[model samples]
Target: MRLLQVVESAATGVGRHVMDLSGGLLERGDEVVLAYADWRMDRMFAEGLARLEPKGLKAIKLPFSREIGPEDLRSIRALRDLIRTHGPFDAVHGHSSKGGAVARVAARTVPRRLYTPHAYITMAPTIGVRKFRLYRALERYLARLGTGTVCVSHHEKAHAVGTLGIPAPTVHVVHNGVAGPARGDRESIRAELGVQEGDVAFGFVGRLWTQKNPLLAVDAFARLRAVHPEARLLMVGTGDLEDAIRARGVPGVELLGERNGPQTMHAFDAFVLPSDYEGFPYVTLEAMATGVPVISTETGAIGEAVRDGVDGFLVPPGDATALSGAMARLMADPALRARMGASARERAGSFTIDGMVEKIRTLYAG
Candidate 1:
């Protein structure tokens, strides 16, 4: 089977998803092609494309942008042309807003088209209410034209059907998956980060953006420091808000921007995600697989990933006080953290990349 995966900017979650899916498909004897918009500002997509090439997956660059304009129309035409030439594909899976829109429209000329909004455009915190309503309307319209829609979490599926008014029958909730860590030397990773044996490390893995609520994390860490000064917060990934996050000057915070590969997971003793919203964050799953206890806001599909007080702790969204208390509680008790971490590792085994691939293959074959 031949699958064409379309996404805007090969960066962050959506980009990582495309690469993983492509690699998995190749391993299963299916042909996979990844098409992404040019990411000039950040070479993240380029780096991902380079990595994917070795696995026999081809990456195509298109002149597409997130913001809808004349260029987008031209890109849509280009997509249609590409489909005409290379498709009759078993499936065309689109990720993100712009890519979903383009792929759905282009696939009208073809047959099988599937769209997975990593996170819906209408649900974005940055978009205004009026614009969000418009995008929601557009998504509803597109749903009728597409073959199927995949939601990363049940919460996301609820929002799509309940809030966005998309039909329930067409949507499937396929949870995101992560590769388990290769059992890195924990003490070595900690020592390299300059953390002592007894020191507690709190880590967050995401862009330092408003949607991610990195400022809330800083504030929570500040509160946590009052009780446990030895607790360190290691923030991974860089974004526009990096300077502002640094400006807050919370004690015992280390902002190590964008460490790629397994080392990013190894650096953290425990993982915390204080995001305002998410579509099924891959980092949370990665943290869990790495045996790191996670404290996250009950946003998007996070609740599905974590059973509060079982695998990890979940607090209300945007609640800095609750976040701090959770972090502090985990930090103070090593036994509690260890137990949560063990449970997390066990739970993470269910959401493997192979499962995700097999599900997609079934969806396409059906």
Candidate 2:
């Protein structure tokens, strides 16, 4: 099938998702075109995309700010022109809100237009209620446009129908999948990060933006160290909240910004993601694939992936005390962590990129 994938932010999970998904399709001999705009690490991610496509990647000037505006209209116009010029795409898959808004509107001639919000705008707690209502209204408007939607997890699917007022038939749940690369040199990575041999490292990987709620994790780690001083927190990736994180000055927390996903996973004992909200995080899957038990909040599709008390523990979002307690349990019990780690790896095996591609292919066929 000839496919075009559109995304707004091309740096974090959505970028990784598009890159991996597009490459998988291309490898299967499907013609794939990826269009993106306003990514944090454009040069770095662009290089990765070029290597994946080699043929070329299309560019769309879009940003992840708000509902329809002059810039959004311009993006919609530009993408419409792109679709017209490119002509006759079999499927156009849009990732995240901005891409969904643009591609669905521009897909006048496309056979199948699919949207995955990654997480719907209403999922964001930081936004004002007025804005949330407006965005939901826009979503209701777009819902009538008749493009099928893919929610990243079952939890998110529920939100689409119940909260955002999207028709149930319009949404499908596709849990984010990840297959991590070979383990990195643990000794070397640990040495670089200043993690000692016996340290129970709680790691986090993703943007340090407000949505991620890094402070909760940091506060938890600080409390964790009082009980288990050998505990450490390894943070991978940086974002808008870097200065704020540094200002907090939490001890035993090493801010290792933006290392390789799979390789860096090797240096962690257990993974922690204390995000305020998530659609479904690839970082959690990546950590699980690396055989690291995850301690994440009970939000998004996390409960679907993490079997609480078996593979990992799920605390309430933004609850540092609960997060710290979970870490404390994992940190003090090596045997328990090992058992959970094994289970985590086993759970992650089903979420491979190959599996994701096959399922999406079936969706396209349907």
Candidate 3:
């Protein structure tokens, strides 16, 4: 089948999702064209798309703004023109809000119009009621234009049907998947990050943004060090919170900005993500695939992946005490970490990129 994938903000999890999904489709003998937002494109995504281009993936750029603005109409027109020039794609799948909005409107004539809201804006814990209502209304309206809404987690599907009032039948949950991490030199990576032997290195791999709650990770790590002083936090991403995080002057915290998240997983004994909310983070899956257990907040569909005490630990959002306690549990017990890490690796097998792509293919066929 021929497919057009549209996405705004080709960075982080969304970028990884587009890159993986499009590449997977191409490998399966499908013609795929990606319309991405160049305005918000990141180097990682640009390079990934370039790599995929040689493998029969076609990528185009559209003027998609991060916010709802006057440029949406122009974006919509651009997608419409692409559809006309490309001629009759079997399905048009949009990722995230801005891309979904424009793609749904522009692909009204297409037989299958699908959307994936990695995480709805209304899911933010601190969202204002007025803004929430507006987005909810918009989402409810736009959802009807598409044949189906693909949610990365059940929590997001609940929000769509329960809060946003989208129909139950139209919303489907397809957990994000990964192809495991490429092998990296564990000793070399740890030595480079200054994580000495006998130190339990906890890694955080996401944008230093409010949603990621990087500060929470720092606070939890600090609390863990009071009892387990040998604990180290290797942060591997940069964003708005970089300066704020650095300002705290926390000891044993290495701010290794913007590295290959999966490759860097080799250096970590455990992966930490204290996100305020998430649909189903790709990093979490990648971490699990690397045989490292996760310590994450009980938000979004994390509970679906990290089986609490089984594969990893889950604490309530913003709870430093609980987060620290979980980290301490993993730090103090090498046997426990090994056991959980093995379970994490075994569980990671359930979320293969092939499984996700096949589900999506079935959705498009339906």
Q: In lDDT terms, which candidate is top?
A: 3
Ranking by lDDT: 3, 1, 2
Each candidate's number of clashing pairs is 1, 1, 0
- Pairs in clash, predicted candidate 1: 237-258
How accurate locally is residue 296 in candidate 1, as Cα lDDT from 0 to 100?
94
Q: What is candidate 3's lDDT per residue for 105-155, written digit by digit as tens? A: 999988999999889999988899999999999999999899999999899
| Shift of residue 37 alpha carbon in model 2, Å | 2.3
Top candidate, metric TM-score: 3
Model 1: per-residue lDDT, tens digit, 210-320? 889988989999998977888899887888999998898888888887675355677676898999988888888888998888999998889898999998899999999
- CA-RMSD of model 3: 1.5
Off by over 4 Å in 1: 40-44
Please report, in order, the local distance difference test score of every candidate based on alpha carbons. Answer: 0.84, 0.81, 0.90
lDDT of 3 at 154: 91
Q: How many backbone collisions does model 3 have?
A: 0
Better of 1 and 2 by TM-score: 1
- Reference-based TM-score of each model: 0.94, 0.91, 0.96
Candidate 2 lDDT over residue span 1-366, tens digit each = 778888876776778778777777877877776767764546556766658755444444444444557788777777777777775688889887888878888776787889888878788767898998898998888766646888778888898999988899879877778765466887898888788888888888888888789989989888888777788888888888888878878778888887775688888999999988877787788888888899999877788889999889999998999999999999889999999999999998978888888788777766
Off by over 4 Å in 2: 38-44, 55-67, 240-250
